[model samples]
Target: MDHKGTIVMQKYELGRLLGQGSFAKVYHARCVETGQSVAIKVVDKAKVRKAGIMDHIEREISVMRRVRHPNVVHLYEVMATKSKIYFVMEYARGGELFRKVEANGRLPEDVGRKYFVQLIDAVEFCHGRGVCHRDLKPENILLDEDGGIKVSDFGLSGVAECRGADGLLHTTCGTPAYVAPEIIGRSGYDGAGVDVWSCGVVLFVLLAGYLPFHDTNVMEMYRKISRGEYRFPSWFSPKLKKLISRMLDPNPSSRISIAKIKGSSWFKAGKEGEPVKVTSDGDEARRLLKMNAFDIISLSDGLDLSKLFETESCLDKGCRIMSRKPVAVIVSRLERGARAAKMRVSKKDGGLIELESRDGVLAIEAEISVVTPVLHLVEVRRRYGEAAEYEKVLNEVIRPRLVDKAPSSLLRHQHSLSPSSGARL
Candidate 1:
């Protein structure tokens, strides 16, 4: 009904505008067919385009699709049209983790420990799947009605092989106070280690109601992070201090891993009932079945797609293609479609077809893998380029062919569409 069009309205009954960020707004919505309450994030493609952060958006989508854990927020579906991108995500009724910390100042040790355990479980699951969440903070964590944790926001996640010669994730991003020493050093930081560091900071804040490293000066903050300089408050249990110290170690190589952390006294003490698994059915399951992590990273250049997909978990890198098309047939059709779009195409091992921008300034790649005798999965990625242009090419040129070649039984086309309740905020 509004200028944004009725595309989102056809499927969802938008309730109220929940919240707004620079490029997107969250709204409470109910599925027209199922009447299920969902948080729909309507991202303004124009705003994202202007800001050149479409890749970040794509990365968030890709990362969320690959992960399925009780502690992680579930991404139900992604729909996009000409104007906006709609992310149908699970509604966390209890709101942001930051709010709880703000109200309580400091949580009870047991409560903080419980949240930390849930966080660890989610982070551990992600790492095992070869995905690293670069940003971990109270603001990014959410709570559900049952007071369970739901880690959200993956705009800064690192998707790749868990361990490779590629060394560290060189990206310098994340909230400064929660960022790791290695990430601040920027000499290339291990994805898992930096993530652990952030988690450590999160744990500290959950228990202490303050950052372990603080400074009015940015330089001082960086210096503190680099030195891993932070004193545990006297109120902290010795066990807690020891565990946090190990997680926040300045030397990433020597930093405590999730496995060791799990075995630690503090972590073990905080353990409780298992995480609550949100039900995935119908469209959610189907979309997840065909979801691939590498597809989202294709816009970046020179990244090794093969290594990332080589993991043992079939569900990790590639989504099952619900079509009957053979791998070769699918690759041929995609290559043909890409060539027609004036993009350069090159065949690679492992059913990969690499694409180069008309001028060879950017690179993108796609692959089709046979997961079972009848089920196949198609995955795409961007090697590296301008985020805005890559998004355009992906949506305008590549996505159509992907949908066209995909079995109609498996994919549905829709316009793009987040979160909250009550009157418009």
Candidate 2:
């Protein structure tokens, strides 16, 4: 309302219009109390109700609340009156990642790798929390002041509960260029698999400065996607080509997973020599897992609006085990077990232990956190490599060594968020 004369909300002073869509408009705003900049998405309740998309709004809110990661956009809070709903979110000063690609025909390999790494990390985190972003494109990825990624636009996201009895997500939703081949078949598809396909497209666009599949005719472009037709430019490295090829595989089951992507030589090349902090103190590790007020609110069913629309599922893909052993004892056992399994073991900061195969085809990370005075949680996740190989190692080597069995609980972590992209393709 500073210059446009639009009536501003009591908590925020609306500034310039950032963007808009069919039923919502996003505006730059500042908190009246803290003066912190934020993006406020103003939605017309009547319009969404008329369009019968109240479910979409509710789902978006639910998914955002569940996912809190650094590379993804954050939803600060939601406020609603009789006619409007406002989504207060983080303000990304660097604007849309699409604009960067639009201005620069192609990005340097290092720059593209940097963004791709962040993108994969964030996407993997969402998948771990049982959420899949159905729409992933440069337009939906924003850049923060430090030029890091902040993935936005969750209106098309699907949670685990959205899957049918066939164990596949049925809804066909995504941009034509980025849509997976299975989605085009009108058959059920795994939500995670489709997201991986879109990520491959994004990586291709980032490096080549153009879509892998393109045609003036929309149907033709989709046909290209369905046929798995795409070519690499002359400048693409052999390693990059190999990785992308696996990612773009037409067969969803054969397509490379986020784990394998992390283990790829090209991906690891950028991460080599990065310092990782390691801690053996149980008290310190527990302090790191401590929750804040917002986290408490996110975990509360009474405060979640999505519950009104649908029952929330407790499905999580991450693997966790409880142990009564001391931090040092657990770390020692993990190192011994990893070495026995023919893996190269290394310690990283934050009580993380990294295990990698000799051929560099598989990598797994184990993190230790003190859950209580007597209980410690060891969360094991595949950073990169084949899923089968990871499972084999976990079952044969790591799990046998850890003691004290208890039901696995959710891991609490806080992540940054980005502005909402009101527009949709």
Candidate 3:
């Protein structure tokens, strides 16, 4: 299916074949001008038409564009010539799971746990936005140079809410080994359920270094999946063993949902590796500790506090001078760019300094035991004194956009570490 146009193949400068799929051939390509490496998946139109896979290919690209997650591949550009469709994607330096797992023999339990949680988190984001990745397998997950897994290949993915009641994925897609029993049995099943089931299988593979239900006979694999029988390695934690059991449940209705999956004891068990340290300094402790409504007399940070405080004697006949409580500005994460939005209080450390609005109106990513003092309603009221209105405004106004990106008055700062979540407020 070769169609030649004025478009130059040398422009792409294909280096080597990255991998070959049933429908497409991917290559490591470089831009002649910029010298940037990219993965280009070329799908032959004739082959696509022969297999009647145009719809799947269309949906695959559509799904990939809609999903924006830290652990998902980013598609840079797509182009089509007379005979070939090209998908240009970010090049990941890390190799395939086939080689990665082969090198490690088996992944460590903690390592498996981290990847599993990230996988679920990405899926949860998809479900939240009404999409479901119907096919999830080790081969479909690509890793970056840092060993971070980026889920790819959305060709078999479908919208979870739009799926028919028959739940059979309507397409009979996904790998044979990772297919949920419900899917293989032709029972209508939710798309989300099947994905979770596959995740369970992946977990099993990670922990035991083998597939839970494998047989040369397809019928035997189905029987095991239908019966939902699987065993744990003796070395596996009880929590993990129990989690996989629930997730691989034969009944879709009984299968765990991704949102609730995180709250599961097994998922929470891994978090015990560290006590959360939310602060980097004593200033953070004192700033988070004292929060009260102040009589905020101005919208500008440069408003003369001394001058404003000196003018409070009009209501008091005897008092010549009146004192106003200073506004306690505590900066916290603003949703606009989804960065750690904060109010920069001081530049003493030669770094970005932000203060949390004293009135707990913003947020603290802390548990009750550590953040109890600020959250105590009675204490908040008592500490608020006569400045309750300041608390109301802090919650309603000033604290919302402390670090927003577009059209924000907050300090100009963007996170280099986690830049994906930033959005305009």
Candidate 4:
């Protein structure tokens, strides 16, 4: 309410468009009453419903509500209306840590060590809270005005409840370059160990200004990650190299734990096991302290999420299943195979080909994405009337036609509709 007695519909004063994603847009904003700076994430409910990822969004909110560490981004409140959902969060004025790495090429040893400590501390905090940041990368880390670390974007995060009977997460998620070997193995992996591996990769990037696992080939990259076959630069110290080796070990059991990392001589050198001291913003503190638990009921009041559970037209409509064949061969085989199967060809663009079954019972989509000279990924999907029909088409009609001499290891490991949801065939 302002002095004029008229009602103000907008709660925060939106400044600039910070960033935009497929379903949401982030903006720089200021609290109307307190005049404090904040970042507001405005999500389109319609898009969320259409994409069928409302649960992922809710999980993100739930996990963020439980985290209150200095290195983790502070999620203040969640407000919603009929169509839009808003998340008020602490604003990071300094932008993503990626920008810093890009501008400077590589950071000094001391600087890399500093950022590594913060990242580890943040991961430790999240794991302690029964949360795992599945997607850990430089772009997900934000820097405050004082150049301090703040882990953001829990959209791909998983919590304790997601753990399987074996007490490991089976989801294959995260950026390819940073993902652990265990994740690419298609076997269940320990969340904590996975985060540690990603953090180790981030540390390497900070110091070397490039990914440790490098190849024009995705399968080759996975092979390198699986074998723990990355080399440290000449500039890296012996102690740091030793620590990184332990962290990047292919065996999760052999990988260095966060507790061990904290106790390591290299990690404790300058700080002597003392954690970085970051002061909380006054407004942020007040907001967080006032609201402890996430009011999911109130947040979702009057909201209908039934559409989110229904199978809407496939969102993002593609998968990245690895293949070793040349692009020309892969494309030709796909087209010829679709024709041989008597499907009505609809369109072809670059490596993508679309076809519909003659009887109109199913729609087939296929595409090829080249990761390296020798390694490529074939994306395939079939949309049908029911789950059974979809599987029938996949196993009986589609699978046999697309078989290639490419390494079986490619498709055997990484093929899922949505990694976060743990979708598999």
The prediction achieving the highest TM-score against the true structure is: 2
- Name the weakest run of 10 consecutive residues (lDDT summed) in model 4: 295-304
lDDT of 3 at 209: 81
Relative to the true structure, how large is the alpha-carbon lDDT of every model? 0.71, 0.77, 0.57, 0.72
Please give, for residues 164-199, the per-residue lDDT of candidate 4 as tens digits: 545578988999999999999999888999999999
Q: State each model's C-alpha RMSD to the native.
A: 10.2, 10.5, 17.4, 18.9
lDDT per residue, candidate 3, 142-207, as tens digits? 888898888888888875323443323465777877888878877567778888999998888877
- Badly placed stretches (over 4 Å) of model 4 are 1-9, 273-425
Best by lDDT: 2
The model with the greater TM-score, 1 or 4, is 1
lDDT of 1 by residue, 291-373 (tens): 44323222122222222212122222332223456666777777777777688888764335778778766666675544335
Candidate 3 Cα RMSD (Å)? 17.4
Using all chains and alpha carbons, the TM-scores for the candidates as numbered come to: 0.68, 0.70, 0.62, 0.65
lDDT for 293 (candidate 4): 28
TM-score of model 2 relative to the true fold?
Answer: 0.70
lDDT of 1 at 279: 43
What is the lDDT, from 0 to 100, of the residue 318 in candidate 3? 8
